[model samples]
Target: MLRVLTVALVVTALVSPPAAGQPPRPQAVTSLLAGMTLEQKVGQLFVTYVNGQRADEEHPDNVRDFGVATPAEIVAKYRPGGVIYFDNDLHDNIDSPRQIAGLSRGLQRASKIPLAISTDQEMGLVTRIGPPVTQFPGNMALGAGRSTTDAEQAATITARELRALGVNQDFAPDADVNSNPANPVIGVRSYSGDPKLAAEFTAAQVRGYQQRFLTWSGVAATAKHFPGHGDTATDSHTSLPVVDRTVEQWREMDAPPFRAAIAAGVDSIMTAHILMPRIDPSGEPATLSKPVIDLLRGELGYDGVVITDALDMAGVRQKHPDARIPVLALKAGVDQLLMPPKLGEAITAVVDAVKSGELTERRIDQSVLRVLRMKFLRGILTSPPVDPDKADAAVGTPENLAAARTITDRTTTAVRNDGGVLPRRPKAALVTGWGENSTRTLAKLLGGKALPTGATPTPEQITGAVEAAGAADLVVVLTSGLSGSPEQQALVDRLVATGRPVVGVAVRNPYDVAYTSVPVWLATYSYGAGALESVAKVITGEIGPKGLLPVAVPGPTPYPLGHGLTW
Candidate 1:
């Protein structure tokens, strides 16, 4: 039955809608677009970042940028269509569910049109909202489990929590195929290396996010970094990375998940910052390239809201100044300018472009209508405010956490189990690893001593861990990003030399197994609480490893994509 469903989905994805047959615009959206002024219409094209948890609180960044100290004032002055939240040390928009709910209600109160509140709640390493929001081991883990049902359930839980907090849109389900192991930005964020697998999981997640969960409406799902960011070695946040895949190669390797997303009727598609010179020789990144955007619209028939990936990033700003990026993105058929560096400059530039005949108000209307249609379709206009008092009851419930744990349990893959080293009880176990929290959790779960290593461990630390390994019958070393870290690999190698029956666990990227040789190798894909618990259960024979390899591990003896071992 699952095989039949998978085949049906892939078949549907391959068949694109005719170019001339577009979906009819909602009359409410049309009316809303007609009533809006030029400034308001231009404002609808932008989704900016603002600081503070409350709408009324004074923030330095808001004060300097918008000349407004509060979120409400900024919203009133700029009239942006949406707002995105980030949780960092300097400025945090997420604290607790009730706090976030209050912030969402306050923002809605200030806006004439309801705002599409969004965040990058992609759940593994890229998670923005923390506990008591249920954290699943991310997309790669879902791929490892090879269960479309689990994938949809994870997204369903994510959407439910976000809606309770009054966040209407989610920038998630990274559609990039992680074909390149050296990729810095999108490693485990991607579902699988195989295009078909990635497409299936991407489609399932899109459906999960858009489907109504319980009492709350669905949050808008975004299939991100189109056409694909999987094969790039560079991080677009710092600089522009170019993918050199020919048009045919891109169609086969990079375009499947995006096609699946469009077929599933994803609410939005976020453009990548990297340059695909093969597609558009003009050297513009996909975020600001007409040919690239046309491929999504003209070829894929994705007429939904097209958003840029953070215009403030160095990738988009490399060719043009900060002010010109919004206009170029709009000109390239991008509907929403996400996180522009200077919001005021971006708005002024768009307004000036319209007045100077560089861009038509109709062009602005085209994007605005799309954004308004999304808001209306997603029920953002009718139900903007959420109950702050009931948010705690909805988010991170025991049922949600249990579901997350079950999914993570299914994702623990035993890649190498030499001599049946796993599913055994060791007299004394030593837990030593790069992640402090993960190592500590594993140590506690195993009732063993933990010697945590930094991301880059010193010789003395390695020696100390080795010396500690001698006292235990079993040693488990947690590795992360080992493909690039020789020192961490050396640490694992040195532990194996101790003849202590070492087991290497990849808590981040599964590619760590390729960099080292260990008698027993297991991959959890994420070091989150649920994943850590799952790994512990697999090690102690409480549960067998049920996960398959989502991506191939290249080493002296390469493991194929579907490789997994069970007791």
Candidate 2:
């Protein structure tokens, strides 16, 4: 039985239709398009969430009935016009899920501009797309793709899944230049530390998502962590992360991929919450900076929508609580504000800023026009009302899973299998797995007793696992990182010296494999189960291996790029 199952994609050809060759912009924008006051345009600049539980406070009757995004009522009373998605689970079922999309449709029925809903769903692990759905590796995995083609496959598969789910905006393909290994929050989510490779793959991912243009009905692709999220040790979720890389370093390392993505016609750009005093010197996060947005909009020539990361994050609310971030973000030229249900409060803030001459109606209009443009391009502005019920058969179909597996097959690279560690033609083989998700996938694929080797392996544990495998004449190690910490490196070294043709799989960032000379080095690039199953197929000879290292596998020494085997 194949551990990796391919499911056909079920396209909801009806709900939200694509605007092919949409004549630049559709004249058929929503009737909501009909209600326009200059103040509403400025108000539409901020997109906040409505906590359903808070609905009762704003309208007591809302709880008794479907008031439509009750949490939004507090702010909707003010009328800021955009909405964003976070970790909120919109449904209880995976195959047939009833999502907040329904609620969103309900709210848009009342908004000024068609509300744009967004999520940080770069890959399956980063989202709540329901179960039995295939997930690809994160940006780290895509960066590890043996070639630009690999990244494209990963991107294409990812795009298909999101489109099927009725999500119009994906805050994916992290463009941040992550040179620092210690960087938290963005480790496996980034493409590469090398700007050139990152740029190439970023473009690849764009193509992947774009290929499904018709299927997505104009889904917006967002390349984020702009100005770079890598090189910072701090996580913005806890407090504001400060990037110390000077403007010069950013120009060379951090800016290329994002520039590439924008040029590729990405529909939107997301602002990072980090502060780089080097760039602004004023101590403001990129989401609230005139300089940052100006650089992205003016210098980069990104004319599409500009959105902020979740405003509810600690980085924005804690650091600059009283500053009116949503208002400043728009004045700074961001087209959409994310996740502030206190839409009324945010609108009042923006209204004050404009009245005080701190912001102009023109500035607000610039953003509103862009928001309208996207909805127009998406065929949602002037299109028919999308009944959420029409979406039932469209989410997570077999065809979509096949697309994901196809991408995994294309992207998963088998760099080395010297000594025939693979095609373990022998009756049985011992396999050791790694990471929470990957370990599970490998076990399912290999179909035998497998042991967990942890992130970094201990010499004793590795030796023990290898010895156990030696009994079967082959030892396969699937690892993202070595475990057993300070004393564990020696154990891995000993396992290699066994001359058992140990097969090693790196989950992402082939950097860790540089130090050891494991005869077989496979870089899968992510924690997705789909990638793991692909790797198992490579070893079991179910599929021929063709992936090469897209990035250098750094260790004490780095493996040259294009390092992989041909079947």
Candidate 3:
């Protein structure tokens, strides 16, 4: 049987609701709070991660980094209502999508309550699937376009792939509308600068993509950064950033996409750790803010589940250094306390809080009820049947991968070019220390040698590389903008200053291209194997540049959005 534990537990309650010839199975669901033991109800609100497996460890999957127990043991021990999967949690045996399905079924079987398995496979940003997988540029890349069709398409494929592997819920299609490119963390993770466009795209993504499980009976979608976390410049992993926007400004800028997502029936909302004094003056994170949670539940009319960002993030850690957060989060209306790093302690803390009247049992029961209701609606309690192989039509097939390649290819941008920089007259070339891409491999493909430099190249590196060309042919610099680091800008400026025919290509975010005046440049939005191969083919002049500037490049923002300049 293709059984996941959460569904199994739910099915245990549902299997005998009516006769086999039932007209419609009644929509009766257990109030996980109503009929369950206190311990079981409290367990319903906690989510743990289990990437490692050991015999004696206390916490499951060692989300606390203690490596105490394996993922299976964690589920069996705590019976958490949800589980979060990091890249490390994947079993190595999952070479194809099918194997991943089997592994997921096995994990789900270990749980007693219906478990919602969530993975942060943001489609293109940090995919853990195998080769032949098409890479969609992260949310930022898709945001540059006029329509959200691309994002919807990419999300559809993502849902299909994940569902094939038995992943029920995905924390993706980030609804954060980022207005600033200088945002150190959420730059590439977001969709766009325009709030309305981001909302429209996110709506399409959730509506079009969230239908995967509904349409295919397997995958479900969750839109994230609820109550808005994209506009702030600070990284939530470090400290809680105070979004200085007033309520009116927030409604205008940051609230649209989330509203759109809610309209689209998103299964869950992940709270941001950032502080919004305007929304909650207590200086607590949105995760532990009753005002903010109330805003989502009441004002926004959100009737779905509410989950907190990882309790281990510094945003929560700094405020409560004692690891007693899951209790406070429950009191604040959070349904799931994700990856607390201290499961038993977190559970005990909640129990203690209820005992002392610091946290009420009724409050915890509210979230538990919501969780159980959802499972009941999905028919997991009585009928926990899954066809892990059925998603084969959607996941990893050539059709889906081809679509991934098409969008990825569309994002490769040309940031700059002065005096017709392409089609170099001479054949000589000097390539070195561009970015962390396969520049040398491409150079070799074009029958040239790639060299390593002793000192990090200065404006002199490009000049030296160009000058060393000695009128040979072309000097191409490949640089990667992992986080759009300043060192990246320095490298490009040095290369462009060389006054050679510099074609600087950013293998990440297109916004990183505006910093340099490189005579020629491109942004290939992703660094996957397919992305690298495509960029390499373009560099060797084997293929004409078919990509357009997905976003506005500095200076010669020559091509308008989606403009493809043909030679």
Query: Residue 370 in model 3: shift from native, Å?
Result: 2.4
Write candidate 2's Cα lDDT for 1-567 as tens digits.
011010001112212554553324322233333456756766667665444422232444333332443644533554555555444543122223345446555555555445565556678346545444446666766655546775676566555445444456667777876677666677667776778888887877776765533343446678887777877888888889888777677888888998898767777788888888978988888888888888888888888888888787877775555438787778677888876534456667877887888888767766776776665454444444445675655545687667667766766677765666577644555667466456656766776556676766666676677677666555666654443243335545566787766777777555556645577777777656677778788877888776666555555656676676756
RMSD of each predicted structure: 6.7, 7.5, 5.1
Deviating ranges (above 4 Å) for candidate 2: 1-34, 37-39, 50-80, 87-95, 98-104, 110-112, 130-137, 140-164, 207-216, 246-248, 341-344, 387-392, 416-418, 453-471, 487-501, 517-519
Candidate 1 residues 213-245, lDDT tens each? Answer: 212468999999898999999999999999998
> How do the predictions measure up, each by TM-score?
0.95, 0.80, 0.83
Candidate 3, lDDT over the whole model: 0.64
lDDT per residue, candidate 3, 1-567, as tens digits?
333444455545553544432212223344334567778888888777665322222443255443344566767778788776655533222355554555566566676665776677775555656554445667766664344778778777776566566666777778887665556567567776667777887887776556532144434566778778877878888877778778788888888888988887676788888888887788888888898888788888887778888888888776774457887777787787887867788887888888899877777777776776555433334344345576455566788778876776555555455787764433666665544346666466556556533224455554555456555466666665523455445655665666667666666666655554666766666655566655555666545566554444433333455554434
| Off by more than 4 A, model 3 | 1-27, 31-34, 53-68, 88-99, 130-134, 212-218, 376-395, 423-434, 438-472, 480-490, 497-499, 533-567
- Name the lDDT value of residue 170 in candidate 1: 99
TM-score of model 1 relative to the true fold?
A: 0.95
Error of 3 at 506 (Å): 2.3
**Model 3 error, position 445 (Å):** 6.7
Better of 1 and 2 by TM-score: 1
